[model samples]
Target: MKFFDVFLKQFRLQWRQYLVASLASYGSLCTGMSMGWTSPVLPQLRGPNSPLPEQPTLQQESWIGSLLVLGGLIGPFITVPLSKHVGRRWLIMGSNVPLLLGWLLAGVTTNLPTLYVARLAWGCATAMQFATVPIYIGEIAEDKIRGALSAFFLLFINIGFLLAYAIGPFTSYWGLTACGGIISLLYLPFSWYLPETPFFLVFKGRLEEASSVLQQLRGKTKDEVQPELDSLQAMIAREYEEEPKISDLWASRGSVKALGICVFLAMLLQLSGIDVLLFYMEELLAKVGTKISPSDGTIIMGVVQVATSCVTPMVVDRLGRKLLMWTTSLGLTIFLTLIGVYALLDNYYKYDVTSVTFLPLLCLIVYMILFTLGVGPVPWILVAEMFPLKTKCLASGICSFMCWLAGFIWTRFFRDVAASYGIYTAFWILAVCCGIGFIFSVALLPETKGKTFDEIQDLLNNRTKQGNPGA
Candidate 1:
């Protein structure tokens, strides 16, 4: 009863902030799933029976997919700075416009060129939303509940993934477009209810506005809000006392290492073969001899993703980021290695083929669970927490760009690798990458558990003294 009361109290106090964060977070999920959900349908879309134009060759389809990923690579570098200048609310709201437009075009277009253009636009908008939502969530949440709230972002992302996976298998192009439109409509009313980031408002010298926003967010009266407001002002004043310049990101050794750490982590997460499974789950399952319908595969994968993501918010703060990442990497490496072995046995060795094939499917499910728990949630949490205020926006942009670049590389090449070297060999390569990631986490990653933003800044700056350059 006491626990329930506290839960209710927190909800009542933070409901508005929660609603905004949830919606913005959902936008990111919708965007990622919008692209990912379409992957399963691509072969059909390009088949002779497709309602659109004549089908392209597999190679041409691959090239078009690469273009969409390239758009994601370029978007963050453009949007992050814009958000810093224009404010989070406007930038987030603006991102949805292109997404909506892209889906509209995709659903109606009869030509492949127009479809490619629509996907490129959708990628850009999705990347923008992904890069900004965390910054907004981190800025608005109270320190006590920040971790939980931030984890909610991952929860929504998994929810979107699940929805896409389930819906994409059964829905036609028109149905997918309608779903995208619904997500867009939700964005307008949801974003309107959001209070501006107090940090951004205060930075603009709108103290009164900042105070009111902060009070409403905390569900407190002015008297209760004053202490937090005063603390925020002092923190901002100190941050600006040195007049941080954009160049500081590359100039200072600490900042440089901080940027490197974020970029490396982002790259590691993508190369872990998680997205390969996400974007090509149905195809991947078929390769391993699990010949379930695409719709069924998608539903299974989605449920696993959501279940694991739900577990993350509970364990993340308690177990700490470094441990979670290390554990995830280790688990991924083992599962992937086992998957590779099973593939080889089933396809080449042909010894006990039935066992070999079925075992790999089970391992793949395990891999998904491990991924959701560690890699999926931990990387985003680290990216959100690792940077100091002065360089956060710039650093996040760079990191997100690197992430998309890695995604582009993986998506572009995974198909060729599977075609030439075989699925088993590809899984082997991912296993090796996961092994390398585990080493990196242990040697380079810092434990940011229980630290405030300022303390994390100090820790990041004191890297050399700690004898860890990556920290």
Candidate 2:
């Protein structure tokens, strides 16, 4: 069959799975993007022209930023256990309630305390979606399409970033918050249509429900469903039989190695300074003596984000995760370093407008393109695939917590860092972080492309055996 014919047939047969995956993915993306929107506004929200109090200094802003990070740290601890007890669908759907209310409250609040509460609430809702959605997608997708389907999380996140970046600067805070409320509305209809993950259903011992979802997802008849269901049941049974405890995560050499890899990868992605760039684009642009208005700069940033996001999925599987990440990180490091040097030259050496204006913009564009292609998508993909089934939730939860904590650190500090150290110096620090990321990717990270979950688990187990020499 032609590719489109196959796609249409699959959609027709598995509309429910598609709908569920799309909705889950969309909700996750919306929450992530909502947070991205506020990055640029933090300074403005606390500036002298702002309506809020001035008693809290930049140091206080950092403290408030930590609250957002603290929310991320707390969420997975709360939600992951709940997901095992309840179900992914409801947990995911329910998260929207706080996200919607948080943004609405934030938009209307004048008090700093109320705004912090809203941010904390928003962070909790975002963490819930983050923890559940990938697991949902992993459990629902067939082995053949799992990687491609998983990429949807990153793709939609970029879409969210693009939307927020485009809309944020053009409108008032209230209008932007309203946009978040509208996006939150999408979660309701999604909850109505989304199916419980087949893995979760199977885990619950609902064989018939699992079988039905399998048939729907594969566009298969009852005959075709049995083999897949049987395979899944066997896999789940084996996993539960040898379930690894949280203690096993640090005690086992292989598990510890995998955990370290995930944490490092996630931290590298955050500390690479992409969040700071996205969040502080207006300020960064102004720092370089560029005349572009905040609204126009944001629109430009949005366009670059969307344009580069399209490149990752097409080449992710083909390029292999390690190569893509290393190449992108190296490229980003080079471009960022050059941008910093140029900015320094602009400040110190008095370059002409032509050289100063277009060069830095070109470098920034290159940095964005490199980021989307490699670092943006690879960390999530790797984290999702790296862990064994038993450790998946706990490991992912820890990794995501670290990721958010890193985000909180960068968002909280970048403004003050820029103010104190200069934008050029800040970019230099980020360039160094990107360089370190490249080194780690080359030395430590393993290739996971085209590997099934079973194969990955076996590999890790074998490595554990080799390392222990006894077990």
Highest TM-score against the true fold, candidate: 1
lDDT of each: 0.76, 0.74
- lDDT leader: 1
* Candidate 1 lDDT by residue in tens digits, 1-471: 675577668778678777767876767676766666555567567666565767777676666566666778767866766865788888888877777777787777887878778778877886786677788888898765666667777777778778777777677766766786776668677767667899888878889999899877877888888888888889888877785677878866557767877788888878998767777777777776554665676678788878887766656665777887888899999999988887777776766766444566678778878877777777677677877676777778888888889988987798799889888999999999999989988888777776778767667777323322223
lDDT of 2 by residue, 65-157 (tens): 555555676678767677667887888878877788777877778778887887788778877767777777878876545655666776677
Task: Measure candidate 2: CA RMSD.
Answer: 4.4
Q: How far out, in Å, is residue 58 in model 1?
A: 1.4
Error of 1 at 63 (Å): 2.9
